[model samples]
Target: MENLDIAKFGGTSVGNFDAMTSSYKVVVGNKNSRIVVISACSGVTNLLVELASGKCSDSKINEIIEKLRDIHEQIIIHLENQHELRNYIEGHLKEIKEQTLLANKGTNDQLTDSIVSHGELMSSYLFVALFKHYGTDAQWFDVRSVMRTDSKFSCAKPICEEIKVLAHDKLLPLINDKTIIITQGFIGSNTLGETTTLGRGGSDYTAALLGEALGVATISIWTDVAGVFTTDPRVVKTAKPIPELTYIEAAEMANFGAKVLHPSTMIPAVRQEIPIFVGSSKEPEKGGTWVRPVTKSEPNFRALALRKNQTLIVLSSPVMVGATGFLANVFSVFAKYNHSIDLVSTSEISIAVTIDAGTTTSGKAEISENMLNELRQFCHVKVETGLPLIAIIGNRMSENSGVITKAFDAINKFSVRMICYGASRHNLCFLLKDGDTTEALNELHKQLLED
Candidate 1:
């Protein structure tokens, strides 16, 4: 198969019949052999989360069920001759409903993954049947069969080598034989053959992994938006679409709160030098952001990423100005608690770090109690919440003259809590009061970007 590209449609992209129609056009218009990945219809995953979390008990479960039925029956009524598929979806929903009636059990992550997986599973099945109805030669695949992961039910990391072999053995032949091969994103199976889900915004990760396994050079992420922007459009109205970015730039933007793509989504792609294209399912003519290994032109500063709900943890210890294992000790607690932190500014006497307190997922707490207690053993710890971390992202930022003064000038009006610069090649980060995040972004966009 020549020119095989992976195209993944997001939840809203496959959310309804109209959305599916647009996506079908995109899938069918392509000249190359393509693999199609779809997420659950919009809102389905959240409902599943409620059910799986036991947030909706027996008394309240019926409400979520009615909503699910309304959403699916709307589509099912139109997917002619797929009674088998409809029954399959209905069965899964019924199981979810029944499971909710019982006390929610097992690893919370595992239960949530299993229940929420219905989103992708149902979406892919309905989509494949639609493609067939419209005379497209599409074959549906259960991604769990091929995409292998650990037993870590939520946030399951793909075992690349194992997944590569499994995908090659199972998916390659299907792609080779058909013009279109359809599968779900954000869901995989463990070695135990139990259902598992990747973290939030994981559909992108699934698409890229499959593309890498098949040796495709690029993967297209089809979503509701047209492209990645210079900054979040909601924050800065003048934020325009960036035509292209290197993997580092995109990864930095993702890490700094570019919601278009997941931060870890690029790891596998970067390893194989597989590029990514982010585009809209509805409006394909506008083009989109292209992320690859190299770029024709480089900008001094490309974009700004703002992450809110941050907690700044400051640790001051007088063990000595020079301490042997302080760095290791502080980081060890992070690992022990499975805490994912963002930025760090260190001094001889203290360490300042920022993490997303909003990292709480469907049914999990962000801060770990044991980790916090351990950290207080040796250091005076002060935690401040309600701060937003704004990252100014670029390439070769160290060499960009005046970029620092200019950024600082833009946010000078805001109460700046911390600034971490010259530490990372891709971004210069600033901590700001939550109230000042928007004001800072607006000023920076005006001062630093071209309208």
Candidate 2:
């Protein structure tokens, strides 16, 4: 209940006319000052990436382009007095088509960003049209002008000081003037005026950043789900919604594959203690999950998170025993490739680490041949694919005897891989076969979250 509230809709939430209609009601139907941030239509970003690959045949790219055109045209046909919005779409799509064709000739990160950023651009303006159709005064703006970022391209970091200035100077005035500002999320610009992205699932980060800059206490993320669940409801039918969580729990769950919020989404919001709500766009009346700092004590256990397609690498060497700078040398190789480890365990003779099997550019599985070859210079490295990680996320895990006992006992039927604890009191991580992931998650959810 702040003066100005920020609402961000994900791909699924704004994927179609029905979805956008729900969002339009949420934004325009409200009396408060609302800034709406939107993602691409559900499937647009993926197809756009294909078109940008430069490897796709002309016919294939043309097919994707036609699909994009059709999706927008379908929605526009339903609107009244949309000449301006339709004209904007026609001109913008033509430009984007040209950019997509030229994208393959550029650097990897830059090229990928150029194509993927179009998703948010298309959705934001389309939502503006939806709001207008409902007889609301709505205007859409370019976030690139306000969300100033560094030149990291796909994974660019926001220069907060610069963004603070731009957002406050340019956006605040328009917002206060009673203009419901709709802007694209997941994209920004570097100081050099190049289009950049905040990585996938960044719209959450976008809202958090803007909410923090506007000095608001909360940002609402409208998604397909009712709220953050104790477990993925699809996986465990008995799973129920969790109403509130500390900022730490939400971030930990996201990091461990609670897909409701992006893992880094908490960074901006946490800096100023801004509460974030994860709610349903389809049914706004149903309460959602709130992530913020709270005064009252919470349960010792919060939720169970499972991440599939994980790869574990174990490096063994006697040299690691009583060795100085040994771990540093091992990490240096990964740093050279810009690869990050997800979970790590080490002993006197060996070190084990887990990383996502998905490629950095797309969420598809990829084997990192180059990284493995480099590690051969030091120790005998063993790699295992098809591993899934299960993390029990909560607070003060070491003292929570009941939940810990129940978790292990519940998953006792399934085989467990590397178990890591104490790295953070907030999490207990273990690796298992990808096949056993679902069953293990269900049983653990039954005890830790459901009970």
Against the unseen true structure, what C-alpha lDDT does each candidate score? 0.82, 0.81
Candidate 1 minimal-lDDT segment of 10 residues: 357-366
| TM-score for candidate 2 | 0.93
**Per-residue lDDT for 121-232 in model 1, tens only?**
8889889888887887888899999889888767787888998899888888777545688999989998999987877678888998888888996789998888999998
State each model's C-alpha RMSD to the native.
2.1, 2.3
Across residues 1-451, which tens digit of lDDT does each residue of candidate 2 receive? 3567888899988888988888877776556647888889998888876766676766776788789888887788878866876787777678767876676465276877877887788788888878878878788899999899888766788999999999889988887535688998889999988999887778888988888888875688999998999878888898889888988899899888887898888988889887788999899899799887872657767888888888889999888888899889989988887677888898889999888754233554444678888788789989888888888888887775676776678778887878888778888887986685677888788777765
lDDT of 2 at 93: 73
Note the clash tally of each candidate. 0, 0
Error of 1 at 64 (Å): 1.6
